[model samples]
Target: MNKKTVKSFRPISWPTKGASAKTGKWRTMRPVIDKEKCIACRICYIYCPEATITPEIEIDYEYCKGCGVCAHECPKKAISMENEVH
Candidate 1:
């Protein structure tokens, strides 16, 4: 009996430095975590598409796209999307 073999494909190139991709500049709004209300539940961190939410519950504005996923998913409503000043 003869068996057929399949070849796997991988990405030709990968991002070199960071995940930012300079998306922050396009965002009109930004997420602000209310530390006073935050429960440290990590919901925001998990929902951040850009992975901009840090382990210490800080949002890295440099990469955040203002998608509002973190604010929408926060159970405690600790995250809010505010208009970007600049």
Candidate 2:
């Protein structure tokens, strides 16, 4: 019988800035979270491709591309997409 060693999982360390640029600058729409309605489920944080949303539900607009994934995945409908003003 052969025994295999199981490897523990480790998360990747993401860089502060993407290779392209600060993606937020190109965003046409931004996600707005209604804190009053938010339950802090971390759904948006898990689904965000940019990983711009924190576990505390705070969004880092500097890196966020405003893809609307957070708004779409929000079960409570607390996140809404609005046109980015400047």
| C-alpha lDDT values of all predictions | 0.80, 0.86
Q: Tens digit of lDDT per residue, candidate 1, span 1-86?
A: 22233233633334554643677787898888888999999978887877888878988787788999999999999888899976
Could you tell me how far off, in angstroms, the CA of residue 35 lies in candidate 2 after the best superposition? 0.4
Candidate 2 C-alpha lDDT tens digits along 27-56: 889999999999999999999998889999
RMSD of each: 6.9, 8.7
Model 2 TM-score (2 dp): 0.78
Tell me the lDDT of model 2 at 22: 75
Error of 2 at 63 (Å): 1.2
Worst 10 residues of 1 by lDDT: 1-10
Candidate 1 stretches with Cα past 4 Å from truth are 1-13, 17-20
Candidate that would win on TM-score:
2
Worst 10 residues of 2 by lDDT: 1-10
Alpha-carbon RMSD, candidate 1: 6.9
